[model samples]
Target: MPGIDRVTLTMITDNYVDMLLPDLPNVTRTGLAHHFDPKTECVQGENGIALHVDVRWGRYRYQALFDTGMSHQVLLHNMKVLGLEADEIDHIVLSHGHPDHYGGLEGLLRHRQAPTPVSAHPDAFAPRYLRLASGQVAPYFNYGLTKEAIRDSGGLLVEHTEPLEIGPGLIASGPIPRVEEFEKAPTDLSAPNALLHIRDGKIEPDIVPDDQALVIQVGDDGIVILAGCSHAGIINTIRYAKQITGRDRVVGVFGGFHLGFPGTPRSKTDKTIEALRELNVEVIAPSHCTGMESIMAIGEAFPDQFMLNVTGSKVTLQAGTQPVVDLDVEARQKIGLQ
Candidate 1:
């Protein structure tokens, strides 16, 4: 359980893109300069989440794609624009069974001729549906993410329900234990009146057991947690990571907190921010399904720790030093593209 020296996370696809955003101490925005080519290449934003994670621990380096965004076009296009190579990714991690999280999987696998390991909870491939308040159940098309499709597209499926090590200092948190009474599944999907899935030919409540997070332990600086859409509350996810890793100090928590989804109570957002504040999370970069209002509220609550994560933005954290934003040149160099 050695810690990593550094870890870099690049947002390949998200719900927002603002090229005018300036670089912060630890956040590099994909500004107009990155699109200086004759064709004026620009990073596209979509209603999905995908992150390129590069971790370095001593002589060992690992690269992973966490979630594949909502479409191959968006995911691949952003990668190209960001100078990240699809073939170089050592693994693929799915946060849940939702389309927005795994939509670009097949396209990414096709792009990489080499078979890659895809880590996820077994429930991620289950047939799921959205249960309306009216009691009608509508099937959710998970964008053709299936066992056959994954296997056909050159993916080596690796399922796990227990915590699994993805790399030197990276841990794939399995099913997060739901302990917080206030942190129920966001009302948008996984709420009791909403989500359902078929199991043994019987429909049952779908809590999105596949929802997980990536925990990166940086030497002394503590752990950085990354999630896709946190169906399992982000607080629960963070607590699970800390409990499992024995790392109480959380450097940051990034990705969709699922607070802004329709029907989700505003109180949940308040509670989430309060819990995060109690944990003393250093950085909070919410994106994707995290509603704008919730994001703004979080920013207001933790102005110093709030980070606006958009497509093509890179957040770099190194041991003993504060997080630094990596410019295009530095990003390319870190991923060995230059």
Candidate 2:
């Protein structure tokens, strides 16, 4: 499959804001130093994910936002520090109904100079919850955006139950098929509620069917998948991408792998890493909910292919090549709209 000339993924907002990798070649750091050290003027990190994907095909350009992080202020702060224009975002793709992924939509829409198209699964608006260790049911709080809110923000809400061609070669996996035995949903999570499911005459864990991923085919570079949380499992996401695109080779994968946190089985990460290596995934830029143990294991195994993906990190994939792009305050100021 022929790939695009280049595709750029900028980590607009992530759980970690990198400030030490200033000398990491093409890697960029912005608006985070201030958060680390109040003395410095920079942005702070948050528990969420948001990315600005810029793809170029010949002379054509396409831009989209993968997720909107958990906080509007954090998203806005990072964008301001990165000199990102909300108006430049042609499409807003939500990974799932998770608050951390879509909570900032209203803020973004309010700031946008024009209404943008927001895409997600129909179940994204369904109430979600996390079953606690104490067996108590608690609502996943702080959800800020609703379908109505999106419409009020001048966003065209496009909900889909199947894969969609969002841009030139960019596609969003609508409902990932869960075929992997080890890749099961977090035992505690349930959309709406477990009780509600039981009352509705059903007994099954919520698989987060709304969980989806963003895909871009880089000419000759294979497929680059941007997974928001990998709640459906990273391996499942990758395989689904290959299945849907009919492109077997995966050049790069970034975003949350959901490998972190207690109660998560080690075999899950181990099996995932084994599968990724088998697939010959050239680059693994894991961040956000990917966890520290998983990151270290992947880094140790992949070595040269492992790259840190935090706030302000920019990865550029082109035909037969991939590189970390730099992002600084100066660079941000110079880049207005376009």
Candidate 3:
């Protein structure tokens, strides 16, 4: 794959940020509410992920949304703050069927009536859940986005169980193969500790067959990997990306690694850090469900390359270049409404 000029990833919606960066160079003490009209609800931080990926190389440019945050309100609100419209997105690729990742589909379609394609794993819509400390398994209320709802939004559902090339050098890992022994879902995550799915009129451990990630080949810079939630272990996800694309150099890995949870064991976190150190990726930006313990461990291991993906952060990556972080904003006056 030829090298791309640059890829800019903007965190449209995420759980946290040390500082609210509505526009770059001018950090704000308050959230977006300070810059935009009060009537227009300000963009909110949430326990979800919605990324705007803009890739540019030579004369070509491609745009995609990795995930739509749990709520349409936050997703849509953040888009407006970023000066982006739903219709402008070239395509949509979902990491899995989790509600927090796919719940905003209906709102996205309502905003952009265009029949843009949405690529996801075949089992993305299967039922899922989270187990409580009391040994009770609560069905994820939001669960998955329905096909009917997607159609209503003029979204073209493209379901696949295998890896696919979505853009010039972008490859979506259809279903990551689990090979790491230490990287497993927590026991309290469920009785069987597996995501549940309904198939053949029966519900069983889900095993999350649909869990995948997007791999971008940036020449010698190796690969830039993005995951919605690495239900399939992050190490496994990275290895699979390399296997499918025949690229061993992993430049960066971002998005949810499923590391941050009460059920997540310290041994596993340590092992993950050990594996990541061996892999020696250039940058590691973990966010959302990537538990604080794991984040701290990874941060300590890769201090120079570690970055926190908070809401309103813009991370830029290019081949043979160190990752750059900045406020995803320009001058407030420039984006101010008349």
Candidate 4:
């Protein structure tokens, strides 16, 4: 068999935790210290959006509050609640520049060590816009992200547009290529959005340099793919991850696909859905911007494989181990609407 990647999601932060916790009685947690520190994120049963992706060596965890719709960037508080000290964090990678993705960055910097050499695309900065009906456009980020601000977050900052190995068997999917026709993430991308440009007309910005993903191998037939918002498009991000990790099969996708394009019809999404199915994804743990309708579609496509992700949710994957839990309380509460 070809190479595969394993995946897991520790709901680091978000809303709807209560609805997602009840389904977690069987989740298998191996590395968590059994002392039961309320300061740490220990989810035995309950649901919320404290989502993080743990890879083989250097895993990715969300240290910030990623819900702009809700006013809160208290990532440090949440991190403490989850029991992960910032000083313990050695490496960091960003998904985009959105407030939710970067909101708690300041809190992250409050840790003992600086998150230098944090991986992200130059496009992480720049004004964002939301495409509304009647062709209405509003500032996507009422509060835009500034590069100088991110630089001060922590550690060394290394801006790379190409895929680079960040950890053991882990690869940060860089600026993905817009090769597929399944989904076109309508970004406010343009040459003007270029955060890094040496000469005139040297690079294009519509590619959304801020958009990227993380890939890791977890088990024999598992390739866990984690995305932030997938502003790069799920298919594109996964394809790039595959290219970067050289893994042909994807066992899981646990992150925000940004499938909340309000007017996007289910028919239009079918194309992308088919692509996801083709990838042989065994789990779909979606949260944040992955809209409700889209979740239903994914549930149909994957059935029991579709796991609802929310605040306080937990997904564990071990070699030769079956899923211990899927969705927690919050997820189930929001499943049928209300």
Best model per TM-score: 1
Error of 3 at 103 (Å): 1.3
Off by over 4 Å in 2: 23-26, 31-40, 140-143, 186-204, 321-338
Candidate 2, pairs of clashing residues: 2-219, 3-218, 3-219, 3-220, 4-218, 4-219, 28-327, 31-43, 34-42
TM-score of every model versus the real structure? 0.91, 0.86, 0.86, 0.74
Measured by TM-score, how close is model 3 to the native structure?
Answer: 0.86
Q: Number of clashes in every candidate structure?
A: 0, 9, 5, 52
Residue 75, candidate 1: Cα error in Å is 0.5
Candidate 2's TM-score reads 0.86
Q: For residues 101-144, could you state the per-residue lDDT of candidate 4 as single tens digits?
A: 66655556545564545677776765555444544444546254
The most accurate candidate by lDDT is: 1
Supply candidate 2's per-residue lDDT for 263: 74
Q: Write the per-residue lDDT of candidate 3 for residues 1-338, one digit (tens) a residue.
A: 67577788888888875443344331222354554656654557888898888888888899999989898888988888767778889888999888779878778888885788899987887766655567677776544488878887788888988988888788878998889988755332355344456766677676677888988888665788998989899999988988988888887898998887565678887888888888877778888888766776677666566665677777677766544443222222222311
Query: Can you tell me which runs of candidate 1 are displaced by over 4 Å?
Result: 132-136, 186-193, 321-338
Q: Tell me the lDDT of candidate 1.
A: 0.84
- CA displacement after TM-score superposition, residue 244 of candidate 1 (Å): 0.9
Output the TM-score of candidate 1.
0.91
